[model samples]
Target: MFSIFSLIFGLLSVVIGILATIFWIWMLIDCLKNEPSVGNDKIIWALVIVFLSYLGAILYYLVRRPERIKQTGQ
Candidate 1:
């Protein structure tokens, strides 16, 4: 009953939804386990992921990891 485009969109939605869910879960685990200095930043990224869905989650993983940031002083 579904057209090809419909099927494609359905698949895309499922994949995106799964990816977002997994990313949020991983972010939660990471926050709980680590004492990263940028805790607030990480939490904000996690909220952005949850609220904005797939693209936001992907962006959080790609762009906002605390370990990737440079610290200026000890």
Candidate 2:
């Protein structure tokens, strides 16, 4: 009993969710691998990503990843 628009919206939602999950996982791995473990950065970022989910990932991608890559070239 789903209309065409409703069906399309549902599919779009699923696709977005899947993409968000992938982004989240990718950020987590990138943080763990590329984030320097000088102090507690890696642990802190991992915790933030784990607790905040996609939002944390987005934050890290926009904020720390650029700086880390620039500083460490990793």
TM-score top scorer: 2
- Evaluate all candidate structures by whole-model CA lDDT and list the values in order: 0.63, 0.94
lDDT of 1 by residue, 1-74 (tens): 56988999999999988876887777655544442555486567656766776667567557655444344221
Model 2, residue 7: displacement in angstroms? 0.3
Q: Number of clashes in every candidate structure?
A: 0, 0
TM-score of model 1 relative to the true fold?
A: 0.51
* Candidate whose lDDT is highest: 2
Per-model TM-score versus the true fold:
0.51, 0.95
The total number of steric clashes, by the backbone 3 Å criterion, in model 1 comes to 0
Can you write out model 2's per-residue Cα lDDT over 1-74, one digit (the tens) per residue?
56988999999999999999999999999999889889999999999999999999999999999999899999
Q: What is the lDDT of residue 24 in candidate 2?
A: 97
Q: How close is candidate 2 to the true structure, as a TM-score?
A: 0.95
Model 2 has an lDDT value of: 0.94
